[model samples]
Target: MRSVAAVLVVLGAAGATGALAQTPAPASPVPALDERVVVTGTAAPVSAGAVGRTLAIVTADDLQRLPVASVTDALRLLPGVWVRQRGPFGSQTDISIRGASFGQTLVLIDGVRVNDPQTGHHNGDLPVALEDIARIELLAGAGSSLHGADAVGGVINIITRREASAPTARLAAGQYDLVQGAVAWRPATMGVFQGASASVDRSSGFAPARDFVHQQVRADFRFGRTTLAVSHLDKDFGAAGYYGPAPSQEWTTQTLVAARHQRPLTGAWSVTGDAWYRTHGDEFLYDPRVLGARANEHRTHVVGGGLRVGGRLSSSLRLTTGVEATGDWLRSWSLGDREEARVSGFGELEARVGRLLLYPSARVDAYTTFGSAFSPSLAVALPVRPRVKWRASVGKAFRVPTFTERFYTDPNHRANEALRPEQGWTADTGLDTYLGGTWVATVTGFVRRERDVIDWVRPDATVRWRTENIRDVRSHGFEAFARGQAGPLALGAQYTFTRVETDRLAGLSKYVDDYAPHGVGGDVSLALPWRLSTAARLEHRRPYGREAWTTVDLRVSRPIRRVTAFVEMANVGDAQYQEIRGVAMPGRWARAGITVK
Candidate 1:
């Protein structure tokens, strides 16, 4: 099957060029390869067209064209990234990078860590309002050298509302009684200028059991060289018993405010610093019969700050160093847990000589309630040829045990306070080749080895769950993407292959890994005249021991002056399957919407 798929892909490419000498190929609309340069993945930014790993950048224009309601849904389209969906309304999304668990992935909003130290689950609950997003930069594989900690898998940096040269306001409405409105004011100032934005969204949802209502607000102010911002969000939904036997209900609210400043000390020297505070609260209620003891409430608070400085030591030597400290305090009334705090700091340096770039970074963390630990990383990228680049990196990263891992006690599982943090080392290598004005391709292979993997183990014949550190586990994967823009058309495709190995579990018979089987996907888009555009996506996944399924999605957009009309068709092929456990995904859903800017 794999061979057949590969052959078909090759044939398709050939057909796009010209099948035979008898027929002339149609003029392609895709842009030239020189335009594919990317800036991400390594300590020093490199163009996707130059060399490095498989990095994908989601531009503001891309966000405007797609018909997505949540950020998690948008992330699924990226190469080597997975979104574990618990429900349709963005209830609980577990994002995994390069097959790493949720906790191993680090998320940043304007360089601020949003991954709650309390639990990996809340990492996806992004504190920032999505409507205020300007751009999303995703770098796959270990990024501990550039970023610190929780980077075992990858890094996703979400750039929030920044100073724009123009002012913009947008209002949108969609099916399911969904309504959205946003406004932003940007001056023609260069830097250290003030800009602000605000957005709101609400939906009645599509499923009978799923309904959600949410509102988000954000504001930003800048004076001289300093900027301060604050955002608040509230989400209340009806989750009809998706987690337990009977219908369950949950409400979540989170607030975050941050302040940052940037200044230049002297020639070739600059300093930047930022501080943030966040609070999250979750309330859950389960059906009386099935949820025996699942109902509970949880809240968390996190505060931290960091400072970075950059300078040039010599003509060929450049260095960047930084120190960061974060402290977390979480309390759960329902679980009778009081407080858990951790503080951490890190430093990094980068040096470039000729065609080679080297980066080394280290971080040390101290937990007031736990122990202290250290993580170090190193990476190098070299230009093998004018159009070809080679890169590799090795890093150590860790994830602090979550509150649920240490305190939660329920009918199905019992928490263990002695749980230890999960630590891992990642090694990766890749090649990026630019084919002049034709095309650019990137390929990467990586392996992640983790010890003290936290998981639930069956303790008795009753199949009860108990928190324990698995002996050891490993995950290996490879990802590839080729992008080219020719004339009025853009063509791109990404493929990922992963394999996981672990000791067989001793439990009740018949347990599956609960992950997609064979994940491969690609997309194609066309830019037509008169401000019209069209796009298509082909996605395929095979679950363990189950027949693989393929689905196609289609989208069309047209702009008329200050207003745009968009139509989206999900699961155009009407394929039947489930992306997550016990959750039935929608099939062949259609939505039409409009946005005024």
Candidate 2:
């Protein structure tokens, strides 16, 4: 694997030199940024330009232009967001933001929370198909004031496509005996709009016990002011060295059903509500070929619902209030049967005074097991001049311990029932500027102080890993990015510097201190003649007390009539690195695919 990666890196460098030197003729003008309605940071759907918080938006067109296989792949391009994957193609993925742990981040699908109560490890196991995603909204910084628990770091919301213009199908094959197929359709019905999509992906092991199969299906219905959606995902993969150093195999399944409705009550008032149900199952074996070899099975179910009423209270003021309830239950042989319920109430006020916009929000959650908690936040945005803005925000957030951390028991690890919830306070400020009618630049600084942070630690190699509430941690970071488009070419670059201060403990830890202190990334895309296009991405990361690594990826595609063919080379520099310690990532690999619309 090391030799292959080294060779690919050399080839990639040479190819990049030639590609950068040759410039094609100017093709067309760059399109304006899409001003879509985003709902992740606020109580109601509002234009991204009107929000005061730090946010990033990824559109469907951007997904199509990039060589990405999953939502995790697309998120890595954004600033302040980290995606750690144990395997390729969305296998065992975890997301973090602004130096937060995996459990501190929250994920949602169309306003419905999907974070599993059993563990944060499965939070990225989304049921929605990739082709059905319309857009992704990433809200950085504290969001617990609006999203309740598990929103201490940030929020990632995946919005599904409500309508499709035409039927589309895609087929792909690649190294390691990979095969993938997907189909999507939107049908016109009487007084209703309907859509459906399905996909399947399978690959043989790149190494021993590394094979995987993934399947997904989605269906949607819309009429007047009501919408319904259903989705299911099943994944079974060889978990070679996924958990600890043992060769393991695992299977996971997820199902979700959701409904949403909206209606105008009067001239300035509207009512909105949504309800969803989700269930997940997992089966794990230390060794797939050996029967009864330290096997474990677990199942979890979550049901939640929310109702809200919001509208313009006056010409320059808006108000929104809502109530939410969630119930979670787990049935397992090792973790036992446990259930918990939570109810929350939240409200937000948005007022505009001259050139400054003010937003204040608060939420109170009552847990069946741990009493009540309150979160509050305030944000302000001011347009100092045309095409320039200044924003600042301060908030408090908290995360409840997962079931696995509190009750699970195994040979190598044991849970701690006395663990307490994690809490933190976060503040940030930033400036955004637009230059030359084509370029946009942003700079931001943030600080977070956390108390009673939960982590798994051990004193020595002979002892079991136990969960504990460690000491206070202070994290601070600075981030900057510049992006622009001119004629047929678009380019962007970003950098981040983060530092962590924590009281030293006696032994090794799982996730409290592992982070990339210095990171740099960039992307470039060009349009050529004959309906051809190319894109390249570069990423570099330096972890504290660890070796640094860099990687490069390139993609080229051409469209003819209704068909588009593309080729992608990933990890061209095949750097010897691991997102998760001890898990060996694949080296350089290539794939080809065709899509028809």
- Model 2 lDDT tens row, 24-45: 3122111122245788878888
Each prediction's RMSD to truth:
7.6, 9.5
Candidate 1 local Cα displacement, residue 212, angstroms: 1.2
The TM-scores, one per candidate, come to 0.86, 0.92
Candidate 1 residues 550-579, lDDT tens each? 878788989888777878877888787666
- Number of clashing residue pairs in every model? 14, 0
Which 10 successive residues of model 1 have the least lDDT summed? 24-33
TM-score winner:
2
Clashes of 1: 14
Point to the candidate with the largest lDDT.
2
